[model samples]
Target: MDASIFSAPKIDCHCHIFDPESFPYAPGVFYAPSGGEIATADYFMQVMSAYGVSHALLVGPNSGYGTDNRCMLDAIRRGGHRFKGIAVVENDASASQLQDLQAQGVVGIAFNMALLGLAHYANADALWERIAALDMCVQVQVQDDQMAELAPRLLGCGAQIVVDHHGRPDISRGLASPGFDALLRMADSGRCAVKLSGYDKFSREALPFADAQPFTDVLLSAFGPANCLWGSDWPNIRATRRLDYGTLLGVFERSVPSEADRRTILVDTPMRLFGFGTGGN
Candidate 1:
């Protein structure tokens, strides 16, 4: 009998929680997620329970909340070991604030270069160094060839890096794309991990995102099982179409057919990267 994908302990390495009702959106943000884009912590926990997902690493989104991490902080506080977080902060945010976040269960800082632009974080090297000093990771989300420019510093920053969305590679440019190549090269440093998710962000085509598969294949090969992880990208914002959680899992299941690989991506890697354990709720 085939092993069930639902039977194993799984962790979602990237996802977001939007609770504007309790934590209002930051004023004058460029994009505010509403309607289908909202997922309260309670709702997400139920969804996780339904899918047999044991824990999720909730991201502090740039869209609505910007540098305000109260929403995600509250969720982590209430989640009872079921949630960990990556927070968003100003490039010049102080060490005290970051230490406070870390004390509250945030494991990393988010660099949403895709939304905030590269220029915004050009002076972030010191911030990265500080994050590394605290033993936390930097969660990066870059689009097109942006990572090519940032990879050099990020690799040298001494922080554990978790890259978003298979590097959000420009599939039209193929594996030879400079940005994608740079992202792949970061694997050699052993401090980088990539998520197999957010297909809608880079894929020119629909559903299984066939155009993006070559990039994903290269990522899986280059990053290897230990550095590769799975994420639902829950509460997907600005999506071209509706993306169901189960459907997303199915796409990942099809992409990686081997049960051993699946377990590594779904359970083991996230455990190592996000600090989830079997003892947790």
Candidate 2:
């Protein structure tokens, strides 16, 4: 039996990179970019090669770069076939600008509503329409407090929605919590997908990542294998050193504990979500 044939095709659905030494941070933003001087796309490729990840989604980081996607675009271009990107756009970006981004292999747009607040994009309907016509997805990072207030409107905007950071659910509130339940409802409608990343963000513990499993269980059950995707959340920000991409991957192995489940989470699903396949390439 060939090991390559049996080996899982990993697709990382979330990650961020920036060259702090070259790119100046956008001023006046509360959310700072992840530390590490210039962790380039080449670095990520080496890590992926070590882990058997063949493809990845390069999520543009919110390091106060504003709408200047130059660094991210360069990273994706250099990453070649191994990477795709999701970008940040001004609420009023013109259709031509969006079309240009799509041409550059950007498949989605991410909004950090938790930190930026919903009111900023009050006039984003036109941009949303353009995205819908282009068939792009929208990645939203909203914690539980804002999920009730913002998720429905975001979902109603007529584009595929990717919920970030384990749907930003409150673990202490349990599985049936409104935020997690809302995510389930979105998955039920078949228009939403969730990233099984960022265990350190929600859990209070130092290790094992057991505290984050309930949220993962709900996502797995609600979205089934197809609508779920996994991310390394490399160089984890808030909890920083407690977990690296490798540590997260290990926790996933222990928690999921099934090759079939892992395959869907790691491979099949992300390809489908990111439009990487149609008749096996």
Candidate 3:
């Protein structure tokens, strides 16, 4: 694959940083990565540099560290201009705590419904107002069937909505998935954005993930390039086997195929949403 596509500065809208020694995994964590591979800010930066990624959104890994965002915040602080973070906060968390998180380079809050479920957000409305006041976006990782029910509720909170993992569609069911439809509607309203990441998680086929193309096509069409952001989903934990970062980038190049569109997905969209170069508060 031609690596020229990555020569321009790009933003990884989703990725993680973990340090079991400094920020130990939460007891009863869903998935604890063994062997300490790809578990530090330095290692992730090395991989990003190798792929020509200039900036990234360090998402709080809910499954590994639960609601503890210290590792994510530490990574962003150390990464300087190269990183921003999405923290995972308790639904009833105080506004003062959110202010502290925002000061720590966190640009958003994460709701990993895929693992934690909707019940995790019992105080979502109040929390949304707090984050919104700070000009932060809400990043969500949810199952395919949850979109229709969740999108409206999120929109009601009045914060920008960012749906993760291609809306995590059930490709086996094609576009018939109600959640996929809801996602498209959300995108159409210009109130939500979708991360064009995690094809490996949703793809049923082998490498190159050609099987995920149709879903990508629909997303690009529905969300348009301006609202679609690309990410490496680095250290793809759920991958059955080792997956190369370069190969994942290649998959995105093939999936989108338009240099202009790729530029928006890879750079413009995320920068605008996360307020990277704008010197966001």
lDDT of 2 by residue, 1-281 (tens): 21331245678888877665566667775555555535667787888888777878888777647677877788877876677889998888877898899899899988887667778767776777688788998888877766666667767788888888887777788877776777778886687888888776677676676788877887888888788888877645555445666667777777776778888878788888787652323
Deviation (Å) of 182 in candidate 2: 1.2
lDDT of 1 by residue, 1-281 (tens): 55777766789888999998999999998889999788899999999999999899999998899899999999999998989999999999888989999999999999988877999998999999999999999999998899889999998899999999988877777788888889999999999999999998988888877787788788889999899999999988888987888888888888887888889998888888778888684
**Per-residue lDDT of model 3, residues 224-251, tens digit only:** 9999998777777767656777888778
lDDT of each: 0.89, 0.76, 0.82
lDDT value for candidate 2?
0.76
TM-scores for all candidates: the values are 0.97, 0.90, 0.94
**Model 1 clash pairs?**
none
Better of 2 and 3 by lDDT: 3
Give the runs in model 2 whose Cα sits over 4 Å from its true position.
Answer: 1-7, 29-37, 277-281
